[model samples]
Target: MTGTPRLDDPHAFIRAHTALMAPPMVPEVELHLAVETVAIWEQTEEALGEMGLPPPFWAFAWAGGQALARYCLDNPAIVSGLRVLDFAAGGAVSGIAAMKAGAATVEACELDAFAIAAIETNAQANGVALTTRLGDLVGTDDGWDVVLAGDVFYEAEPARLIGGWLETLNARGATVLIGDPGRSFLPQDRLERLAEYTVPVTRDLEDREVRQAKVWKYR
Candidate 1:
């Protein structure tokens, strides 16, 4: 972690390693995205001399995020004038969308230092405002009127923790929305379908080039 390029200057690292690309489903927003998964992951791991780091999810516009961003853009009423939190906000996609849609406040929660930097960079690129907190925020509800998460159900442990938090928030009358694309851990039974979208994705990360993702309101 000492003097690692990603740690030393995340904004520069992102610019060097990735290109700015517009997600096909959410054309209005652009992000610094990885062109290929393996090469970028390998290079970063080799530079840091560590292998346990998770994939660079913050570099890509995931299917779930695309669906959520599109929904927020098309239906500004959901976030307009509301305090919104983009849970596990990778590159601040949905949060940026919420801000663009006239959200009163937008914040992102991410534990990874690299991801936190990426979100700020991406937010600036899109002329959106974003405040990032460094930690897991599943246990705290700060009266957010809208809580949106994208592609967070892929892993089991995180899925369990975040799912429970969302449920609690829903019970408290906060509008909770999840953007999921057939992830194995998504709690489908507990969600009410809101919208579905055909999101362009990389085959290296998913089974298909385009995934049909759904936005669900926690119920």
Candidate 2:
């Protein structure tokens, strides 16, 4: 806890044993996920540069999360002192970024206990405070000023449910935002594009050369 990097420091801590870079989060935001599971990454096709896949899954950060974090950092007015809820907070990158950018508090929800542990550890490494909740998104009822989701609409069932939740949140006057790099179920028509970025993705994960992720404001 003494010298850990945070999400706002602009430094990267890719390894678990090293000091974290950036005040919002550690540099190692990517996680290895099992294909059969609901985790973030599908699988790795090529070996990453100095990045290791520990065990059965790859713990990695998606481009959309990175883009959202960068966006929040660049535009502090969007999140300063607001109550933020990071739905499906994989790797806790976006939540940390919100806190670093001056959000009053952040709550991260995920169904996987492993992800919850990862979020807690990463938050500690980055010297950020966050509340981790373990549960499915369908039952989340707490009202928040903002809800942030990243690359979650890859599957059919999950996408449908998540989209409905976003709509509900929007109806409740909670600003809903998603960071999507063109997943199959991305509802581009239902949301307005706030920003887009050409994110470097591995061919091992997908066939595309790069993922063009967009930050969308839910309508």
Best by TM-score: 1
CA RMSD (A), model 1: 2.4
Candidate 1 residue-wise lDDT, 1-219, digit = tens:
344355467788777888888888877898988887878777765654453445577888889988999999999999999999999898888899999999999999887777888899899899888889988898998999999999989899989998998999999998998999999999999889999998888888786798999999976
lDDT of each: 0.87, 0.68
**Per-residue alpha-carbon lDDT of model 2 for 48-118, expressed as tens digits?**
21243222121455777767876777777888989899887876788888888889899998765546766
TM-score of 1: 0.93
Report the Cα lDDT for residue 63, model 2: 71
Q: How many clashes show up in model 2? A: 27
